[model samples]
Target: MTQPSGDPAATGVPTCYRHPDRETWIRCQRCDRPICPDCMRDAAVGFHCPQCVQEANRSSRQNRAVYGGERSADPRLTSYVLIAINALVWLGVLATGWKNSDLIARLALVPKGTCESLSSDGYYPTALGERLCTLGTQGDGHWVPGVADGAVWQLITSQFLHVEVWHIAGNMLALWMLGPQLENVLGRTRFLALYLLSGLAGSVAVLWLSGAGQLTLGASGAIYGLFGAYAVIAHKVRADLRSIATLVAVNLFITFAVPNISWQGHLGGIAGGALVAAVLAYAPRARRTQVQALGLGGFLLVLVALVALRVAALS
Candidate 1:
């Protein structure tokens, strides 16, 4: 039998067993094994043994499986696309000479005024509640009363109506940046549910807090909700907490510094997203799916109830 080539007891210099003449100064970072230059691969963090390189690749693939397979797959969340669509619609409205059209009046959540208009035109009331005061002059600069009537559908539709180009652009930018990662992690359905619910919660908060003085319209509520969800999930998974905290702080600063921004919507959306995330994250694994579904359903129902009450109150 051939004798081993290198001195086995040398310090600092690891002699290759196969080639005793060659000494290795670097240790493989992955396995901490002594390896010659011929058997080393440069990795992002450090050098790895050939065997460890293969194992690292294998582990990366396994983790990808839990993230819904292929790294290049499309995101489940559609918030970015939705933002684009809303922008396109705004442009189309401008192009069609409808820039000043009452599109928002028709689609936005102006509970009191909408209910009154519908009721006067023969719509039946659906719920019993106090009539909310309406703010701002309506079409042709005419003062309209009870614009704050609490219509639930407004909660969903309000997210699509922005008061200005800058408003929509800001919200869309945030959505585009944060939405893909969330959609990937939560899957499409859950991501969408969170967005819609957050928007509704924000609208509700505005109605409650402004109580008919402010005419609120924007997607910031939903966007803030996405941030809230990310923060909660990051904590639960022990992800990089610093990143989430930075995002929250930057957005909060903007909300406060900017004039005419809807702080109520931001707060409401954040609270709603965090609450839903907590419910989903803490439920028993077996019951988690059911709990998420039921929770979403209940939230939607409450939104509908609010809308009905607003309609009835105005009537």
Candidate 2:
């Protein structure tokens, strides 16, 4: 059958499908439908209709970061969230009697459980056995469980716990500075993984190196891990290293020279961060994401193994 023909004057040579009342000779490059200027969207080859353009955009692969993670739209958002969490926890500690807070007893990383005097906020000597301390309840002291005694949450909680104003302030400042940078590079998920794992590494160090009764708490380990990750990323991209090297040196000096600083945590964090960053930076492009995931899993297993060994020894 012959196709019906319309008058050219009534509907210019080829009318836009979206605006049949109007006239347009231009056709959509994608769908081959007549389109007016209002409906046309620029494309590599020619114009596309709004619907076709939307469909194409919907089907296109999402942008990815250098190391295969999805690109983050708001890098600073994650950093702000982390800072808020740390600040809020510090406030809780502040409200609960600062250094004497029972919250600290529950959250702070202690390799082995200890007996604490609730009245004086002091720990009883280990020579006084846990059995003896268990009997002396009200006035004497109470048993405070540690990682060995199944307070496993302490490994993570201790990183967020801070008793001193200056301590929290310093760590928050460091986080605000470093967090966004890493997030932008690694994207939110990988960056968060690097951070939490680094903190765990620091806590593990404290568990093994520091005295059993030594109360270790703070984000310094995580902060140190950020520093280590930054250095690794910078080196990978061939950025100047002198500045970061100097900063790390200065921080190391402070870690060792300071009276009450936990050097073990800081060093352990650095090692963990560097290791994670290395995996992120060096993973082969063909299977970048898979390699990164496997490397990180291996690292986590190592940390878990170390913890198991330490717990066995302490037990």
Candidate 3:
């Protein structure tokens, strides 16, 4: 910046353009305009005049990502927030205890909750507003005493309700590892939508493939979705998928080999995530947003179809 000459009386003191009364020897680092201390704002390189600062800010914002997030903002912020929410939810569920609690029964998405059931063996206290079942009570189950009134919200809520610390920890670890890259590439809104939809799809899978009397809950479905998303993103960038495929294969093997794990949910979540990623990664830029919305909506409709079919099969 050009410094004000010391001969103030000869040429008058160089003053702030915005505050002419105040004399100053400083100039804006950006615009080189002489500014008083009050009008000056600290900047990366040096001080800036208020006008220059405003202009720079406007320009910076204009260069932000399509979703209005700064490119330089922490890419992991969305993932961190998701982890925090899941942790808090786990804490709440733990506080309530895993067994015989209305809180958990309300959250776990069970297919039987969506329809009339013959028995309530797998359900919580239905009298407490939980319309319960899941994979168990569809046709042959007994009306258990404690099942709650059934709710459709469980399909989504169940994804966030992990009763075990290891379960949530595993899921969060996977998220922390994979979420930031996708968030940075897809932006926050899209990443969140992908996550939620994938998880819901997983639940829907369980509803369709598992016995209506079976019970399931956790974030595994959503995390599986991220795995699929990471693969698709790699493909989009022309990166090799051998490693991602291997990781997915191992998880799939674990899903099938493990007892008490929701394999149906995991598989369904992966399929859902890959489908969504296909839409996001390959859509034409000219109408990308519209295509993405339609693709996701179509996926959701497919899930609804799956749920409806399950209900009919049991009905």
Candidate 4:
């Protein structure tokens, strides 16, 4: 006997590197390692072993969006969730009694506390309620807390509130139309941050500009913010400007022309969105994420300071 050759190939049987028990003639194109059917992964040219495929994946770069955000697998999912929340809240408000609903009393953004009558028109002064008129004395009503009264939760909650069917309908329509497109470009996380901050900016504007007892509620402010953000992004990517400009102009007309509309909130939201979009779109690729985060943080601090200043002034 010639000592039966040392190589397994001498017996016309070569085992897979990963599975020694299985015999295979196929070899990985990259590593030239024998790969059994179980370990084989299809490649551009020939099959590759599991190890080689994983190595190739590890070395490959991840795909990113224009603003340096990771590409979202489903861009519309976030928008859908937001819509669901607003819808659920609207349904709850309807069930409770629309405008008379205690839910609205607690959620709507009231700049200053108001003594409202449940069975009558016109709000009474808090002092009058304590002296000449009480909750059940002159009328049936309760004292609704305002932002200045430490009802800070209203800043965000008011965004989801709506008493009119047309109001919620129009706002939800605009959101559905604009949200996914923006989310696709900026990714879910960035898009959501832009939305929430823009909405808060509107609330802050209400705190500063509207009458102390004025009631402001609806998603129009945030919707306007999206319009402004879309315009910035459109300009950044060099998309057509005519449509967005026309849309914005039309909305502005509606904001001012329509009675009871919060022009302050709309204008503030647009300005905030434009500033934020500029920060996100123009950040340098070098240290891009860090720069964006710092810029957003600075903007948030400015808003908080504005809120604090308003609170101090109220006090």
The lDDT leader among the candidates is 2
Give the Å shift of residue 176 in candidate 4: 0.8
In Å, residue 71's CA in model 4 sits off its true spot by 2.0
* Candidate number achieving the greatest TM-score relative to the actual structure: 2
Worst 10 residues of 3 by lDDT: 140-149
lDDT of 2 by residue, 62-158 (tens): 6667777777999888889988988898888778877777788888898888877756644222324478678885457678888988998999999
lDDT, candidate 4, 162-234, per-residue tens: 8788988988888899999988888888888888888899999999999887788887778888999999999
- Model 3 accuracy (lDDT, Cα): 0.76
Worst 10 residues of 4 by lDDT: 123-132
Q: Under the 3 Å rule for N, CA and C atoms, how many clashes does model 3 have?
A: 24
lDDT of 1 by residue, 133-191 (tens): 13312211232334443344566766887656777788888888888877777667677
Q: Clash number for every model? A: 9, 0, 24, 0
For each candidate in the order shown, give its overall lDDT on alpha carbons. Answer: 0.67, 0.87, 0.76, 0.83
Q: How well does model 2 score by local distance difference test? A: 0.87
- Order the numbered candidates by TM-score, best leading: 2, 4, 3, 1
Better of 1 and 3 by lDDT: 3
